[model samples]
Target: MRIGDYKVSYGADEAVFRTGTVRVWMIVLFLAMAVFPFWAGDYLLYMANLTGIAIVAAVGLNILTGAAGQISLGHAAFVGIGAYTSAILITKLGLPFIICLPLSGLSAALFGVIVGAPSMRMKGLYLCIATLAAQVIFEYLFKNWESLTGGIRGINVPAPTIFGFEFNNEFRFYFITVPVVIIVVTAARNLFRTRVGRAFIAIRDRDFSAQLMGINLFRYKLYAFALSSFLAGVAGCLWVNFIKIVTPEHFPLHESIRYLAMIIVGGLGSVLGSIFGAIFMTIIPEVLKSMLNIVSAFSPDAMAYLSPLQTVVFGLLIVVFLVFEPHGLAEMWRRVKDYFRLWPFEH
Candidate 1:
């Protein structure tokens, strides 16, 4: 039977993979991911790539809203900014994907700082409305700025390449998406162990007390926004290139809400939760569609009524999770692990 937990050093306590079993499982997980695209079909690989992108974006949102307690309703607009920036860099300046990727993130981070400036004076719903305003403004710019953003026409992106090795297919793109997801998740996991990340948590818990402890709330809040937007930008760059298009319609207000839902359904302030939530949110809808198709095989008229129920079912699932388990899927997963770890014993 497993006994108690122990750590002799601070480093050991703070380690990401604290036990051998966890490390082995992580290794197995990585191996599976590495082998996934090789055996998966084209559609499955596309979904995998999309899931990786969602994980990156959800983690970013979780960092800001969940960890830092900074609410945002303009996240999708920032994503659009990143997508457009990468597209413009590649199409107008003839920059390569490698150069445009970081540049896209930097551009979004700049705007994120500008949008986040009001956080020095605002909080709660007031701040949310401000972000909503930003969303409207950016959307307007995307639609009306013909000379720059293509004015509703959108930009078509070419596949990314490294040293002339073009990632022109879903199989090749899978390599890029998976590695980026891993790097982003690892960085986010490590971030919470740092001083700045602690500062974010402090701000989230109690800004007044955080200030009493000499933490500059504004600086750290801005840092949270910058980092969050940077990751979103990276996701956007990958998304634009993967889809081979950039459009204003892709990043809407509902899209921001969807990202918010991801963190909430996954678990607030948890890195692993972000992954769970992203996968859940991204895959569940597709699963529902498949189920609907199965039902339709028996009843030709089923889709007419069932089509609208898909949204209702999704909303109901979120409600059920919220009402029964407020801590989210991540908490449920933790409970499962704890139960298995202490098998034949109950605390």
Candidate 2:
């Protein structure tokens, strides 16, 4: 979209930041992320932490369902696995935060492989049903396994500490979550450019054709699942540490659907779209609540109906976006940029 930008090499053509404007924007973005927590109030910081965690999970989900075209209803279970794994490592084994985080991801990845084994034989709805089964099984274990998960009572998680520096509050935790988010998002963006990434997309488009091209369907599908679950686990770890608790109720079916909605509302098969979808879904509920509170000033009854109304608006948004904008917010964003890139001129 750069009017005067010229690419002189093949590498330049494939570059992410194709122009000086994009590089400048990237720097400004990093600077903004660094500064936001410092000036934000407590409520804002809490919301920021939630949004950051959600973003990580959403992006991870995108790698599986969006890029790989796999269907899953067990994503929340994977997050739970990560949360519990990190909790156990911290409380039982007395591990440090640095060691626990990556191990949590590894644990989720292992579980992801187990859940994905069904994919070797089933696909589409059948595969989804299999994941649903996995979800139920995970829930059962979380609730009944008294020794590990603490049964129905749930486990109280301690805040993450690195080298004795505790992430005790929202602002301090911001340092942990935000930087991890940036690294994860960047890694995911780069993944799509590599052979493994392209293989996932190929299998997503048509596994038979991908297999014809000598791609191993089982291995790559497992890879997709593991990578996606790893990201989910990281997000789960962040959530457990932030809220300082681990519970079976924390990761639910609706949470899986919510992450699916994120990819659907953002844009399938797009990394930037994943982020856009995450921010959109995370912000909408708050916006609805804020509006309802304003209306409650004149009508006290509005307070009683606020929660349901928010749900209604949320559903309406998904339906509207699907019917009217199937390409999701990412497409809309691109159109806006395209229009402005040319400014008052038509080519």
Candidate 3:
């Protein structure tokens, strides 16, 4: 009775996985993911954890910059705030990891609201500069506040323990990272189906029109910041606990730029794009290093010639994506799926 993938209801039309084939593939993907940690080596697991954390942060940036059209250059500051909050709570107040996790997000959300206040009056590059100022301020605080942040020596964190089990290794922590990524992706994907998420898109498209439609531009803008920073904070907390350390040097301005690039290269405003972007950004460097090692095995001085080009190559790739496929990796992926789905057809 249901033929040719046509939907009879809005719910069906708005479904994240629109077809049975897509749902089956998603199940298969999750099953493969569940099996990955069991077979993956330590280094691969470590990279997986890093990619997971990056996914969380990139998704957040996409929510603000991609979906909401608000640019920020201080996302790294919010991330640092969360890292410090979790570190202080654990080392000083003796809070458990379970308790500190949400607290880290809340703490960052507070600062996000404060920093996002300028978005009410500022737009585009002006707003970007305002966020940049925040980055400088927070970085100064993180560095100079020796009493709290340990003056660049940083703080060490113990592995997270839950229910008498310690997530003390890459293998154990993979479980934690995977679940959080799943929840974050699911929530973000569903978010755009709601009124507030629509409002964000509206504001991103045309704020004056959105305002005329009774949407409070300022309030929604702050909401975007708060939500974005909250996710970044969660990523930060996971980052500190996973690495067993927190430092001022970790969340630098360049780190913020890297995140912006993730959303851009992954396809702005797309949840699946965020994941692809994070994975590509985090893993491609390692892949390049591996290739360099292979070349170095053949020629001892290969690194001397190839090392500097890694960055150039990476930048060039981004440029290519921007010029050829401004929609990012997600669009490329969708096209591939479409090609297969319509194989042997002549239109």
Top-lDDT structure, candidate number: 3
> Model 1, which residues run further than 4 Å from truth?
1-6, 305-307
The candidate that wins on TM-score is 2
TM-score of each: 0.97, 0.98, 0.96
lDDT per residue as tens, model 1, 292-313? 7899999987677665786687
Clashes per candidate (backbone, < 3 Å): 0, 0, 0
Report the lDDT tens digits of candidate 2 across residue range 13-79.
Answer: 8997889898999999999999999999999999999888888888889999998989989999999
TM-score of 1: 0.97
lDDT per residue for candidate 3 within 35-57, as digits (tens), equals 99999999999999999999999
The superposed Cα distance between candidate 3 and the true structure at residue 179, in angstroms, equals 0.5
Q: Could you list the CA RMSD of all candidates, in the order they appear?
A: 1.4, 1.1, 1.7
Which ten-residue region of model 1 has the weakest summed lDDT?
Answer: 302-311
Candidate 3 to native Cα RMSD, angstroms: 1.7
Model 3 misplaced stretches (Cα beyond 4 Å): 1-3, 305-307
Model 1 misses residue 67 by how many Å?
A: 0.2
Q: List the residue pairs that clash in candidate 1.
A: none
Q: What is the C-alpha lDDT of each candidate?
A: 0.90, 0.90, 0.92
